[model samples]
Target: MSYVGRFAPSPSGPLHFGSLVAALGSYFQAKSQHGKWLVRMEDLDPPREMPGASDLILATLEAYHLHWDDEVIYQSQRHHYYQDQIEQWIASKEAYYCQCTRRQIKQSGGFYLGTCRDAALTPEQPCSVRFKVPTAIDHFIDQKHGRIAIPKALADEDFIIKRRDGLYAYNLAVVLDDIEQGVTEVVRGADLIEPTGRQINLYHAMKQPEVSYLHLPLALDEHGNKLSKQNHAPALNNEEPIETLLSAMTFLGFDIDAHITSANLDEIIAWGCQNWSLQQLPNSLASTARF
Candidate 1:
């Protein structure tokens, strides 16, 4: 199959340094393989989304020359698709409704213990839908991280597909969109490592072939905290595109000595695609950064 990858970001805030690194990393990886790269705005949670964050993210990507190949897809507009799949899961008993609160799940020792799997729950108001994950365990080979085994205990735990707020959850929306778009690979951050298992399970449940994954090393601050919008991480300076791109390159452990000073925007990106290597990346839980 010809490679197809994506850089999906939630529009909760402006594009920050960590955002740039993930975007550029995915961009270079796809471009290097001469593959199509798509962008998706994860705007499902209106309560957490900023009004102008999606537009600003696109502008920031353009400023960095990290162009997406197709028109960006927004999650909020695809509610019906998600709803259809949720209905299928519920009707088939592959998923069930839960009225358990966060406190209730916490009381079960952090991980949900299938308290409502057989409770004859209904999707009345204030109820969440959870997939009845099977006991069959499996593993996947990440393009960069090599082999990974999914823990059997976690795999058997019932996980949510739709929130009690009558809104689509991240796992469901992401899997549905990836299937719709034919995303061949997923390139993102280390923070999402655990979620990958649940996503793979969803793929099996949906009977769609799983896509490959390459989780880029997470960028942490001087205090060993990951740079994130929730932490109020500063947005990137579009004024200095090349400098910011270089900083991202460095974070990915790429050597930019050859074009740091000799190339313009296109040349720099061209060089990045040609020389990108996952071998140079640090697989530690996190990598320190000052960018």
Candidate 2:
């Protein structure tokens, strides 16, 4: 299959420097391999979404000259598809409804203790649906991090797929979307490393084709906190696309010494793609000024 990669960003806030790093990394990786790069709007969580954040993100990408192949996909428009997958899992007994409240789980530590696995409740009880995690260790080799073994404790934790409030969980939606979009490889931040195991289990349960994963180092703030909307990270400067793009290139481990004088975003990205190398990425996350 032709290499397919994506940059799926939530529209909860504007695109920050951290978000740009991820987008640029994935974009160059795909372009360098002569593959297709697509963008997907992960707007499933309505409660956290900003009013016009989706449009703003698209505008920001355009301003940066990071164009995507084909039309962008919005997750909110695929609710029925996710619901159908959930129903199939239920019919196959691979998923169960849980009536356990947040207080119960909090009291017993963070992981859900499978209290509702054998509960005598109907689907109409307003219960959240959870995937019955498998016992065997799910292992996958990270393109950058080498072989990874997910702990049994985490692997066995019965995680949620559909929330009690009727929102589709991120893990479920992401897995389904990747399979549907035929994503052969995933390029994302290391913050999502833990969730990769759960998603891999889901892929196995569904018997779907496995996709390779590369978790890039996260950009941090001077205080050591991950730069994010919650941390008040400033949005990308759409007006100064070259400066922002060059900064993102450096974050991805590119040497832009000669091309630092590049006049435009296109020239920078073109040169960056021509010289993109996964081996050049730093193994550890680093802090940068909050621009």
Query: How do the residues 1-291 of candidate 2 rate in per-residue lDDT, one tens digit apiece?
Result: 899999999999999989999998889889999999999999998889999999999999999889999889999999999999999988877888999989888898877888988774577878999998865446678898788777666777889999999999999999999999999999998888888888988888889977899988898988888989989888998887787777777777777767455556678778888899989998774556334
TM-score of 1: 0.96
Model 2 scores a TM of: 0.96
Local accuracy of candidate 1 as per-residue lDDT tens digits, 93-198: 9999999899998888788888888987776558999999874445678888898777776767888899888889898899989999989999998888777888
lDDT of every predicted structure (CA atoms): 0.87, 0.87
lDDT of 1 at 255: 70
Give me the runs in candidate 2 sitting further than 4 Å from their true place: 136-138, 289-291
